[model samples]
Target chain A: MEEREISKAVIKRLPRYYRYLGELMENGVERISSGELSSRMSVTASQIRQDLNNFGGFGQQGYGYNVKYLYEEIGKILGLDKKHNMIIIGGGNLGQALANYVDFEKRGFYIKGIFDVNPVLKGLSVRGIPIHMLDDLESFIRDEQIQIAALTLPKSKAEEMTALLVKYGIKAIWNFAHIDLDVPSDVLVENVHLSESLMQLSYNITRYEKEHPRS
Target chain B: MEEREISKAVIKRLPRYYRYLGELMENGVERISSGELSSRMSVTASQIRQDLNNFGGFGQQGYGYNVKYLYEEIGKILGLDKKHNMIIIGGGNLGQALANYVDFEKRGFYIKGIFDVNPVLKGLSVRGIPIHMLDDLESFIRDEQIQIAALTLPKSKAEEMTALLVKYGIKAIWNFAHIDLDVPSDVLVENVHLSESLMQLSYNITRYEKEHPRS
Candidate 1:
């Protein structure tokens, strides 16, 4: 299939559209107009039409978009149609929480294993996924053909683990660590900087207060 | 202080600058030229100078920017210098993990309480923060003067909980639920949409594979 480059902003919105469409599918909705989808979401009807038009314009002349078809297509575009083996590089609360999320599995990203430096947690399991010692990381990734690794380790250990993951041939990283990781251009890293989000909230609150002073 | 309008893009970059400058401070780096900082970060030197220039351009003509002073100024701009009282709505693993994270407190975001609909989880403490029943959320918010609420609840309950939270006067929300919330114009919400981030990783990995096909 011939593919054209999609803008980053449009790529960012794909997952959101997939999510809403998934919800609609769950509710047994068969089809939806751009106007209806727009009403359901924050995106404007014209914006929805424009974004979808980038992917060959799914909607018919008057008959709206087929919800399931749109949802599946978006999921495929996101590479969610294929199964991806994943491992958690930390067994801390955050890592375990991610392992227990259960949503990732539904999206075809399976948590094949969990690794940690702590000896005590090595034998434990989260949601039946066994935790392994850091010593086992190399063999496990190789054997499982793990493509994506989630880094939930501390700031002090993030860079070291990142280097190790790269060396072991991991292609993608979902980093929760505070520090940035230096990786090869071919490798992908998506950072979930919780503190940064908090800072954004703080900035918004400050701006709001400045605009609306109490009498 | 005279405050000029800052763009959304600039606001997004503030946290990153804050993080990088913090690392410089920790490494005992006293000052850094824009060129040197550019080499360390992905951003270009001219872009760094332009971004900083938005806030009165702190860099000296020839010397450099004082790392500690720049960090402090960015932190103040991000509103990290002031304390924010926060409550997590949900006593699940995600909520517990957020409560256990010590970094938020260091950045002046305190998780004062955790609330859950599960009676079994009530009275349990995560990092010494007490877990209360959902029924007590209203009183807790009022009594503690809570400024921020973190929603780690399931999507099914997110909207109802958001309504209650808004009614109870939460100024800012860190939403983890897989649903977009409707809030008053004055209220602020920062969504940590993990699925969206994962999809982004998936898309990147797919693009990489397509570009560098194994011979």
Candidate 2:
């Protein structure tokens, strides 16, 4: 339980850290201290220690950390060691773009199929992944052993498809739709409310200005 | 200065609270307490109080909080006042869907234009917003006063567009392109790494199971 809360914050930052670590590992850096990591990442050293403490004190007081070991540990914490088979719902620009996306695949998720209600899009191949009609969603998820679902559908259709995913036994959903969904208390849904994010960024500009105070 | 760090956390959670409050507002909820808000939100009450304390203590001793006032205050804090002009880059399914979205306008965000390098997509109306060529991005952003930009471009192009936006004096970009962007330190580039979010959900399921000891 002590580890879980810290992991939440750590998990959010892991992707950014991974990109940096990947560069370091690629460059053959073999060790890093919390101080070194903090300096490189522009965060406080204590923050690095606290975040790492949640996953057991993996760093020694003076010995620093093995870059390879820490990178692997972060990968394990982020569940990047395991490949996640995913399905995209919508088969539109977002869906097609995801199907062809090299980034997710590099990051440990693979899109196996795209689903849409439109028959015209069905049987179409986007970046090598087949587009199936809505009815095939259940079978594709089950047969492909798809573990995650990406909801890029419209708000009107999002809830309906979410229910279908839950009914079909999908464990998690990355919802791109702009609606709040009421799932069973256990289902994990991250609603990517794009507008709200924009609002936050706009507010951040104000927040940053307030903090820095121009000199 | 006393509230800076606390405010960042509170500010992020404000949108979540707003969504929850939006539901209650529709349900005609007139008043709520910190305890009630905590229970409904699955968060700690002390955390709620501390967050609220980032600003002046607005919650009365026993009378709780007036829902309407809180909602309006959060909206203002989040910079959700009036409409925010936005441009959708890439004109793919996700971009078109964003342009086609009616909810953004309802949420005080206006989709001003859609841009694509494709000639076929140009000169067309995406959800009534004119789809322009990528070449016109600078003129369009300046003329329309667009501060918010959503990138649905392929990963390779995401970073390029982000720098372009910074060049055009755009302060914030909601990146949907799934790439880590290098922008000027001053620009607020919010990269919603979809893959990382999905990984978090997957990892959370494992953590949730362990904590609950599900049979």
Candidate 3:
């Protein structure tokens, strides 16, 4: 088993594992070893072994990870064990979608609030969550105990707002702003550049089609 | 140099390399070999070499890679060199924010249109791109040669919409759905699961704080 100081890369891999495991559970898959997971996810068995080791060695020599147990542990380590209070910083469509995101609650996270700098959205309610002003971040974070703040502000505003959120003691940020966030070393900043992901997909699909012709 | 049939995984690393290279460039680093870049990005040196090999060998035996050229070549390989007609499907907050995304233009892609099923957003414009109807997708892609799409639809609708887009001859998709997608093996689907990204960030930051503490 590995320590709790998980590698950032390994942590990122958790989502894929979560999704994969969720499907495996959906299909009534009872147990899975690291090798089975590695084959399905296209990651190495040893890599999965190492990643699993961080939380606690769950895999046995002959038997692999218990699919349910591994899934539960991964969820716990990723903070899905307890309901996470989430707030979106921007009240735009991204914020609305995030507010309406069903997987959060299904995985034990809650949308505490969604806020924007725009004065008009202050009183508006989207998906039953009252939109609030940016000024309310500190109070809301403290009162709601928002463990994750989705930063969906504009390009020019990302850095500024991220700093503001950090001041309010937001632990982690899911930044959709296409800007390079300059956050404190202590705060976790995850930038989701949607376009870059698409570009990669396009390039790969083009190449895949060429190789397979008709898959 | 590697063949055009590079693993999607290797191609995905290009943008990160480009981003890191930009940082190194800004810091006035002239040239960097694979070993140096691998260290900075916390990846293996062979990985750096293999990834770069996908876009032609960018390194020299003695000197190293020409930073600017390497970045440019990567941009080209990722289709960042050509002007891409981009559309944001499901004109929600994420779509609106993406329409206003500042980096796309700078990076050589353009948001030509945004469409939503919501009639309220119909004919409305975000950052100058007129929001259209969902029915307009096929026509627009044909007429405008839309090479890419950013789909931020609801999880329930995500797979269906993505399949539709790929069927409509969309070369690539940037999916922001919080669900796993099933795509044709040849079709490219790059998912940016916001929840997953946040989970990784949270656990990794937990690790970073525990290890470095002060840096």
Could you say which candidate leads in lDDT? 1
Docking class of 2: medium
How close to the true structure is residue A214 of candidate 3, measured as C-alpha lDDT? 59
Provide the TM-score for each candidate, comma-separated: 0.96, 0.82, 0.74
TM-score of 2: 0.82
Candidate 1 differs from the real structure by a C-alpha RMSD in angstroms, to one decimal, of 1.5
What TM-score quantifies how close candidate 1 is to the native fold? 0.96
Candidate 1 vs 2: which has more lDDT: 1
Top candidate (DockQ): 1
Q: Model 2, which residues run further than 4 Å from truth? A: A1-7, A26-40, A53-69, A155-160, A179-186, A208-215, B1-5, B28-39, B44-50, B57-64, B158-160, B177-185, B206-215
Task: Give the residue spans of candidate 3 off by over 4 A.
Answer: A1-9, A24-67, A202-215, B1-13, B16-71, B112-139, B205-215
Better of 1 and 3 by DockQ: 1
**True lDDT of residue A74, candidate 1:** 86
Q: Pick the candidate with the highest TM-score.
A: 1
Q: Residues B99-212, candidate 2, lDDT per residue (tens digit)?
A: 766867877888889888989886898768999997898998999999788888877688777778888988778887656677777777776766667666767765665667
Per-residue lDDT, model 1, residue B42, is: 84
List TM-score (chain A only) for every prediction. 0.98, 0.88, 0.81
What value does the lDDT take at residue A120 in candidate 3?
A: 78
lDDT tens digits by residue: candidate 1, A1-215: 45898899999999999999999999999999999999999889999999999888889979999999999888888999999999998888888889997899999999999998888896889999999998888999999999999999898899999999999999899999987789998889999998898899999988888789988
Interface RMSD of 3: 2.5
The per-model lDDT (C-alpha) reads: 0.92, 0.78, 0.77
